[model samples]
Target chain A: MNRRKFLKQSSIISLGLLACPSLSSAFSLGANNDVIIGHNSHKYKVDLTWGNLNPLHTPVNDCHEMIQDSKGRIVLLTNHTKNNVIIYDKSGKLLETWGTDYPGAHGLTLVKENGEDFLLITDYERHQIIKTTIDGKVVFTIEYPAETGKYTTKDDFKPTETAVTENGDIYVTDGYGKQYILHYNHKGELLNFFGGSGTEDGQFLNAHGICYDNRNPQNPSLLVSARELNVLKRFDLQGNFIESFNVPGALICRPVIHKKDIYFAVLRSKSAINSDSGFILIMNENNEVVSCPGATSPSYQNNKLNELYQTVRLFQHPHDVCIDDDENMYVAQWNSGKTYPIKLTRV
Target chain B: MRKFIGIIIAMLVFSSCEKQQKEVTSFLQQGEIKLTNPRITVSNTLIDSFVTLKPEIHMEKLSVGYEENGKTPTEASTKLHTTISATKPGIYKFRAFHPDWKPSEVTSIKLYKKGHIPNKITWKTSANKKYKGQGETTLINNQKASLEFRDIEWVGFDTIAKATVSFNRKTYIKSLTISYLTDPKSWVFPPASVTLYLNDKDTINVTIPALTEKEIVKLDDIKIPIEKEISTIALKVNNVQKLPDWHAGKGLKAWLFMDEWIFN
Candidate 1:
């Protein structure tokens, strides 16, 4: 059918559902249940009640990254149509949106230091790392360096995620097009680059995510998430391999650090959808699974309602995750048929 | 009686002086000509078609004289024309309505002494292709490809001479068209094969199975053709498969080529 006919049919269907409460509730997970969190901290059993954050009216597509700003406001980065980076607040209110300029924004990070918050973003289309202010003002921009001999052709360069150190050193993962971890000094200078596209012990198939670990204040390590390989490889501040572990999920997007716990948002294959429901796996300092919220098996009936209530919880494709200082979890999801960023507060 | 006579003499002198001042003002007003035309036709040749016309009135008092390449004109028509003449190949402005009424739209008469001719057409190849310059054949992987022509004079319906290019081997020609140029509607291509690529180890071998007599055509006019001295034609090879190589080396060196080259 033509676009007009499709739109007309969709509108009619939507209007019909609006008239019927039960039909609308069954079809839409947002309209029926409010943003719910696991309320009881002691038992760790989530009630799934509507939280303060409202549901966004428009459906989100490929939400790759999210971050909470200095003002306790949640900023989501999505691969919206035509390179638009939409920003939404924690209350599910459409705050302000900008950035049609960077069409392939796949990763976003908010770095706060010295009473200032900066937005560090990566564009797969432009194959570059960009630094902007909290309000979307560009502060620094760096393109893929030609010195990295990994690229046989210019088009083979795509930077996925960015992590900034306390001292302002920036690390970008060339995940989509190229497989390399690029590091730059605080002044936007190319300090060094290591790691190429591979499936070896230290190499990467898709170096999808990166983060600066300040857990050891004296010596900080860089955590790189290799999605396709289903492993999180820990590296030294200078890009040296330290250790690697198998992530519980098939497609691991991003890993967040909260206090002494590390949380990763994982997407399950269709076979593992219901039984092994997609959820955030939290690991303690000993690298042991402490909390597994949502579902642990591939049973559809057990996780269906849980998946329906919080689509991000049964995440068909969870792209990125971050933890605020308050220990609240923010997740960016893709292929969930919704556009709003998901927020999960720790019980 | 004597006082009355002195008063009359003083009045006569004052009248004479006022008459002389009025004559001078009239001369200034008559010397200036107000151009009413506003629009000047832009020809392809001239970069600046500004009119140089001087107003008969004072420069500060002139409201219709040429101001910044014929944007503002003065009330004096003669001065406006004179200033317009100073600029070679100028445009003249005429008022569409009276001064008391706001002019609807200014009209201009373009003075084009000679017609302009476009530069000679040139060609360029993809940077990945080894060949460069016109009529040079480059090997491109079999896919949807393009050959660009630049610097050609844009004549609405005029046709340029076509050159015949033939490939020795059977190759699938997906698309033949021009990019970054005007008249997308006039793009044309030759017919070839679709599934040209077969199973190969190093490179996906895409051989043109057969060639048809049908010609491909595309016409788009919204794009402004490039004016560079050189343009490029691209032969694209697509649908390449990566073969399993036991070597530990990185990246595969693939080959795809165009057997013949031509321009018409």
Candidate 2:
């Protein structure tokens, strides 16, 4: 039978079993297999290893950011009403919950310098940047100063994500409220700010994500995710123009660097306004897409073909992604509305 | 025997007179013509220019008026200016119609001799004045509300310098007070301007420094007297000339930080 027929029959059987408590467990188990991977698929193998990190006792509203610290612990940042950051271990056990300070926390990063780890959080609601510790201690706070020449008035600025270099230089992307990257010195001093709101080669429409690449050590590059423009621009240490790369997907959230490889957690734009399934894309140093199993199929309108590829799985709004030192990937989803962090181990 | 008879006759007359007087007063009161229950119904019929499947509807009607005459009576209208009054307390149907549109769903209101006062307005902010950093500030009045940005970075036009205010909800927001800290040396344009969006639509645009106090444009939409509620206010700066930096000809190291928002 076709996939639709199979799904229909399975749904009927599951609905009928819902009335029987004992049969419910069996039905749930069968439902897990309902995710059918078609032949000749490029999607990666994703295992729902662990979950259940709901702190407010409500379903997770929006998992906008996620990262892994040096200790291999996964930290998930959500845009829920309270308890924005939820920490979990590799085994999916809830370790701790923090970040009641930020209501609309959108982006999160764990900056490791020397031997200390600093948690950098971006507040989309308040339009400020905050640096704290893993235990939710506020180390430093940086509000938008009155010295940036980019804003004409005081009401047009909202910062979404930030990137910090090894030398303590910080670059923050004002994605929502304003379109400029405000640069600050290591001491939280406004050194200078560059880039304006535009659709030009160097300018950005929505500078949603950012990262500092210190691979060369001598000259670190600032990789900015110009989300609306669908391109990532690389800037030199002095904020000079360098290069750009096109991201395959539309809604690219965050780019995580694991060793030399860059993994982008991309949400495929649904044909309809709010369709949610998306997947992850891994790219190597050469910018070539590293095909993996369980990646979701590129969906299109009026197309009934089920392109169940290995590299593309059924991911509903993949917001942020992080990889451990071992190249294991963790993705936080948005529309899924669950606080559980998804894990993808490289086979 | 004469005295006893006289006492019984007097008691009966007094009792009969009292009963007749009560009947006459009751008849007069019932005959007085008055709009017993006057009510008004308001609704937001469209959302995003489309007919909302579930339109928001509210009704206000009660007994709080006096009889003008035995046939003519008047009632106080609701704040919306649309009202209906009944000659007597009973189940009344109200329906509103928009030109070139289908009639709204009929609503039945039961008028009584009692009325309820409007709900008291309560306001709250996700991040108040004492709270620093970025978060949503909500002002709630009844079911209608609005949201304002607190401590958010404002960038556009030229560049925002510094903004400060203390929001007081003593009355509904009659006007949004914005204070700017711009350097005269960095004033590229003599008149710096900004626009405020209520819901993605431009509602107000005003220039800074109010040189004559009348230079500021009091927006019409803003005159509706913002209800005690939370509304999402989007501020955008426009027509600003990029000023040169004082240190060098390069762009100035200027930023805009909103310290507070005052809705008065």
Candidate 3:
């Protein structure tokens, strides 16, 4: 549990020892109402008040995604032009805010190079991927790959996410437009492109997210999220289709890896417009779903996973999740009435 | 009594040593906890033999109560712990119940028995190009679409959609039921009115009320009782020409979606 909850429970127990019989029952009830969510070994206590700020100054619209910098501070990205990036300490205190130019800031990724932190922000409206320092200074920008010959114009390339390998090779997923994975070098030169919109094993429908999986360290690959198809496809670094698996009933937004586990923020259950149908899914190193935070417990039969869906209305359109050093999760939402990120403290 | 007082003093001393965190209030509590509606699933609502409805709720300390005769389900209704076997066609309503939390809103579905199969069907006006599903055969195909308006079974019209059901011979029919999808969030609403022409002679007109606000996505069945036995029926369904000012699509025309037409 987080430090704040630990102190509160400690005080409550200390007071309960000397309180009257009637008051002790109320104390126990208050402790039980901590509102824990998730299942099995991945349960968490809900912290709804995390990262809340005054809307007049730090207003946010469509909290798209979040990540943790090397300084151990939580960074949030939103589409609202007023304050595109908001930094906060682990205890939910606002540290700083910047960037009024990113009107369509959708994806945020942090990469460390030479002991310095850099952020890769993907703006779908601008159709560009920008690299910036931790404090909001633009280092360089990568425009739409016109030389790839696959895209006719800049409007046909709407990049949603970018994954950087250890050697500085960048992989971008054009999720909203042509649904192709564009591979580029560190100098923003397009190398190869593949995976157009199709139902075949090599193609993708809505390749919403991409992540470089280095769990094995020797045989690293790229994991892409096919949101509409409810499948996760694995491809070798050279962009060859290795295999794919289904998470049946989930519209996963992205795959965030930490240690031996993979986490995802399911945008919705079945239909895109099905309001308040979002949840969080967790998978172990073996590529098996072990727990669903706001949904049903994971169960498999005959090597086929059961169709997973939301069981509680704790979240609405959870777009992304960021795991901190303490293993706590910060959830950013999309299209869910302008609200702040919610913190889930692992128990 | 003296020892109890001493113990209370020591407890206070130890509690004061611990640091107190800031008092932060979450805005989530503004919306009180309300149980989500239970999901009711069946293979097909258009049944020839019998249909089994499986009502599911995964939360603990919650029970699902349902009614089969179209009445609103309440806490005192029959607790549905297992699947419901229905041998006849009727409306089924369900709601989730908990002792501490607010009860969920009611969700209902309709089941229709096998009806007269039309030998031929034709539409006077075509549906919107984006949502035309297999032409006129979709109405008599007996396949019902889910709440999603994009389903292949739904044929949506932006204007008045008229269809004629004809049989090889004069077939006796008692009533006609029209199954349509309602998802107000997507600007899909029920038809404003329906006009039924029996054998191109007698006319039956029914006016549908507009929705006051957004509602859940569900397929609703509206039954038109016709006691007069008829062979050929001409059905006309009208779309909402202009949405209400309260709606986001205030001046735009709302879509009218139909999946099936059951003739009993």
Candidate 4:
């Protein structure tokens, strides 16, 4: 079956997945060296043509995150209900789009299960963590944890993002709720929960994002966003606290690891929280910020990163970054006037 | 003839200027206060519960109760929620004085429920669906999650990020509690100000101070004094578009984040 035809037949377009128009600023490579974004070996070229579809049909709002599945399809998750999940091939052609169950659909994570692909989504509106098939079938649903004695009401269970370990253990970050990280088994039973809202070394304020850190490969842990403190905390997989590294002046939404480097969407640059004062951060395994795309270059004095800020007008409240197999980056923005995802091909 | 014409024009201009000045003065008098020693008056008294005062100012000291000849004024206690009340009602006098300002005349009121003063009101953000999230329900849901700006619970707008909530029908509301986040590292500052509309009619304008990590601000009778039944409520937050003059990313659009619009 052709991918575009599959999308047209799936009720994805007619289902009201409205996307705001594209926010591409007209520029040519010959004019300004394209501003040459990225750091060290992770630099990229801006490719505006990448996953653009006519907004009248497949529209996207707040392209939150993207992931490449085993079939080599680029799957993008958006809050836009027209098509909650937009699947595109490497060439930027719409292969298919599915799902309408997630109105506050956020945090797209793809994992291969015994040669099969599954998608995990955290819905802020529903306050539930939904595990679904790539085709959008609800496989498992994890409601808010009550037995933990942490949450007093349903309103206190806002789940923002999720991460699954190699052995199929899932960690859900209640970044918007009580600011705790819940560890669960493959069947979706809570195994452990840790982290809370505070300014302490391990406590998190606006623990907005989370991910499984496999930098050690042998001893994997979790990297959580203490966004308000402008830092990322590392914790052992069992929910034990480890250490925290500061990205001074960068309210990073998430830490995206590609190969040996980690990238972040600096949600804001100055001390402010949700402004268009954002840029991209690329750092090495040592947690040292190497480059700041669309902002001032990263600098370190005595191992402390200087307070960084946006120097370019490229992005407004960029939320997340997804690195493709070819090291290409897809930048998703929140509150950016409904613009489509921006593609950055590795230079 | 030329001299007479010039005099006539001058007279017209002066008369017009006088009318404009009067209008401007009236507006300032209604909206603002001229600082005196203690220009305080008791607007309303809810018996032994709370007393609403008018002409509240940045004060060095304020004490209110009542006084008699050759007697000291009985000072009422204050609460953090902005309340001051007396156990008994009598000849109530309010004495407020600023160290740097001129002395003010004492404000005295006779207590009477029938016609002595106005009244008071209060509101709270309850867990209910009587108020529905109007546009971009994702950022602010029925469950009241995602009120802040993150990848999870925020909607994008061009300049101002606003969230409208419609009541079940026409409803009365008095108080509101709003939460906001400002991350300077990402260049997200607090909103320039927050404006609220009731029934699309009256407005409550609030300016955000320099915020830290996260803050939940509660507004009621003192800070915001509108106790009316409004059908529709609109909360408009201004995104900080530029950095401060001394910062590096000055004059840039800084994203504003808001959450948890609790109305009582």
Candidate 5:
């Protein structure tokens, strides 16, 4: 049949399938019927109704990122000006919500210093990184690094994510604007900057996420996500390129390290951006893909991993995943119709 | 959205045991199992000799079904396992299925046979400056663009686009296939009409149907058959002058994107 006829028939068939209960029931699973996803030992039981709240009261647009606080609270950051930050407990119940000032809130990172929890929120519209207390008190803000001579105006510095070091240093990724990682001391002074937007080995296309990798305390490094290129890049403390991991077919948003594993919220599968193709990826300490929830099983041949793609349509542009103490995953999505985060209880 | 609700209702229908059904329904009501599009990798889309389709199927309970004649892939179609070789030129569609989850949306790729390569092309109307791909060498380069409309291989035009394609010599071209992109979400629609004048004498015209709903980004091919030998061809493609009322940009001119033209 032609394209037009095929589309017409498919819609009719969809209507017919909806009317026939028995035909649709063929998709139902027996034996406990919990929606289990992921591969290997990292499998999880999906909980779609987690963190749901009234949109009129606690509205969210593009639930951008999530982080587990020191007290085990799941703090979600969204661009919705009504409530930019929503704090939820592990049980998916809303504990508190704050911040209408962060209209472009996209990233959330919780850092503990001297027994106090601090939240680093990146606002792309404001073109600055705001450091605030866990209860929404502003501490300080890091504006666009005009001292580095790399930026012409404030609009050229759309910071997407930030990573802080143990010695009170800051690393900010200008992902949306110019793709540079600006390093600063605790005083918010620009020390240096590197990794501009280019095809070079050290540069990036969309340096969307960054995290201070202290996996090996002796030689700590920064793991950055070049989203459009589908690669995780490692840079030393002094802005030196260390190595890169090529993850084909997975547009990873951020690298979240929990225990000996590295978790990434794959933004979209394949090259279609708005196709609602996304999943969760877990990698071992050796950078080997162990499990991909809602995606194909991980496999490698001759040390080169195969391209990973989504198999289950459970996530729509998963931007971040926060692993709780019990290993439950709270996934925050982007462009998912203002829905709340979906939690994955580890089985 | 109905498909998502159907899975929950079906769970209530299939779990025959009362106790097991209760436990299942309670947990499943909070969630629904919606499957993603299965990944299909073709060795090459520009089919010169033969192409291999390798689908990654991990579990035995799941299977990939496909159709070659431009039909939507269903579970009842031919099951694809291991690797399949295709020597002929046609569009191959694939979809994955499992017992407990909704079947995936169909993924397709068109395999075109290598034909006469036109060396030169002259432009009559200009492409949009932002999307002028490689000047005049864009259409005959045989390179495929990604689903993103910003791909450098695609030349975009919002008005009538006219061009003259020239062959190295007087070539006997049986048919000409024009490859274009349709991403309605990006306000890029298929051409309203594509008129081709073969040797300035014979003319063939094709009109694409108006889009009724939202469509996923795709690269489509339309073949216009011309049996006679041809030396030069003039092509005129008209954009959708007015988008339908359902679209957000209703009554506005829609953009037209063309990447490559294959002659066979």
Candidate 6:
């Protein structure tokens, strides 16, 4: 036993304290898993060692994103060139692994076109985005659009994410590079671009992630994260600024929408927005945050979110999150000691 | 009237249960916190005065986190170990904070440093044995971060940062490297000038340029190195007097983190 446990046991034995197992266990009743996180409609049971694999051969530099495929297999993307992608089953068992060409594989987006599912993988180091099949076959690749005249060189096109439309058109956010979102048609032709690096409304600082918000089916909009500025700006499909809202105390990454709710991998809290501070945020259909997984419980006073902070240091730079068919969450972190994704099962 | 009172009590109990659930939503369910008696371990006796605290986390950047003042509920506070020196030297029961989801356990630490060898203050703390004293000696470690004792309150003329080093005999010191963590959260703005008094005789004033970044930066601009053999070394700095108006700690003194003096 550790020193603290020994001290407690010794004190109890000396004082003739009787064990109260039944009473102590009654308060911590959490279905199957004793530990519980989140609040309201988003509470979950944490499983830290869910997707841990041996690091001798299959090592990871940064666990970036995870997604559930059409076959219900959980797919994870990492920067480790040894195996950039690892496919797993729902039961946390390693199914298979593939891809070696992606050294800085960061973003993973699943797109279904013509009744066949494909993957869009963004490479930060190579400054390119590749469209591939589930079997790791590259179909087409996109580089920096020289026609846009915004980028001086190919190095300025470090795209981080891509959101595909129903017609195969894609919107790529140059998050780490020029902070612009480039729009492309089905044939990889540049159509328009929006956002630059600034504090202006139309501009963004570290536009890390982007996704299409189809919650309002009649009017679909694009939700992009200005991570450093702690705001999520909404833009029309043609790349026009619509509105922007604040996510207080969240240095957020890409916005992930699962079922009726929206989720975000908060890279850092507003109070301690440093290198190794991060958490997870969950919002209801009304865009009101109902739960913060690794931080303080979400609270709102007069429609404004209270400044959120990390009460539990569970995550270090959480880059992305993937919600499965069973409402479980698989979180991927960046620069968190080369650890794998953690699973949070909904209780 | 009795039935109404009974219903009100039942409603209050349910509301309290819901409140408790919401409070523990952000708490860790899997991890267990065990805090031991705090120790200040110096890795290298000759030049290293680093102190490793309990419940350590990799502290790249620092913000004034929750302090376990013992009375505050554990679920509401964070455990932090900071080193503070009293005005005079004596044995002290420094409070240790160990906070968890449940009640916190405050441990009182008792340790001694090599104090007052003779006419000069001779501090003989080594790597093997740990000392629990503060002042005139900066603490640093490789695993986590510095204790960051300077990041509290809004006070000007905070004059406790005078580091003194005493040697066994006269030793040659041609050059030295001063290591410090230049983090932004704690507003650790590097000092503009460093004054060093060596051997109770000669004094050297080195001017440092303004710091521009948030990451840790070293000062190697001390042009004329220490050319004489000296038995004692005392150092001080002229720091920023006030914080910027745009900062949260506006009009207050900014904090500076300094550590590790390497003799070359």
The numbered model that scores best in DockQ is 3
Model 2 lDDT per residue over B63-90, tens place: 2222212322222312223233344433
Q: Assess the local accuracy of residue A166 in candidate 6 as a C-alpha lDDT between 0 and 100.
A: 75
Q: What is the Å distance of residue A87 in model 2 from its true position?
A: 1.3
Better of 2 and 3 by DockQ: 3
Candidates' C-alpha lDDT: 0.49, 0.52, 0.84, 0.65, 0.85, 0.67
Candidate 6 Cα deviation (angstroms), residue A158: 0.7
Ranking by lDDT: 5, 3, 6, 4, 2, 1
Clash pairs for candidate 6: B50-B140
> Chain B TM-score in candidate 2, rounded to 2 decimals?
0.25
Local accuracy of candidate 4 as per-residue lDDT tens digits, A1-347? 58865555444332222221111111111323333455555666666556779998999888888888888888899998889999999778999999877888878888778989999999888888999998999899999898799998777888888888888999988888899888899999999998888988778888888888897888898989888789999999877888999888888887877787888888876432225678899988888888777665677798788778654346688889888888778888887877877787776
Report the lDDT of model 6 for residue B53: 31
Model 1 off-target regions past 4 Å? A1-59, A81-83, A269-277, A297-313, B1-264
lDDT of 3 by residue, A1-347 (tens): 79986676566656655554333433344424455677877988778888889999899999999999999999999999988999999998999999988987987989889999999999999999999999999988899888878888889988899999998889999989899999988777888988989988878889999999999999999999999899999999999999998898898988999989999999988752346788999999999999898777788999998888876677888999999999999999998899999899887
* CAPRI class of candidate 1: incorrect
Interface RMSD, all models, one decimal each? Answer: 41.9, 35.6, 6.8, 28.3, 13.5, 13.8
Native-to-model Cα distance after best TM-score fit, residue B191 in candidate 3, in Å: 4.1
lDDT by residue (tens digit), candidate 4, B49-132: 445545443322433333423233433422112434444545555444322222333444433222111121222222123222
Runs of candidate 2 with Cα error greater than 4 angstroms are A1-43, A54-59, A152-155, A270-274, A292-313, B1-264
Higher-TM-score candidate of 4 and 5: 5
Least accurate stretch of 10 residues (summed lDDT) in model 5 chain A?
A23-32
Decide which is better by TM-score, 2 or 3. 3
* Top TM-score hit: 3
Clash count, candidate 4: 39
Note the chain A TM-score of all models in turn. 0.76, 0.79, 0.92, 0.89, 0.90, 0.90
The superposed Cα distance between candidate 3 and the true structure at residue B81, in angstroms, equals 0.9
Q: Give a tens-digit lDDT track for model 6, residues B41-106.
A: 322222223222343222222212233232422333443545332232112222223233322223
Q: All candidates: CA RMSD in angstroms?
A: 29.8, 26.2, 5.7, 24.8, 11.5, 15.7
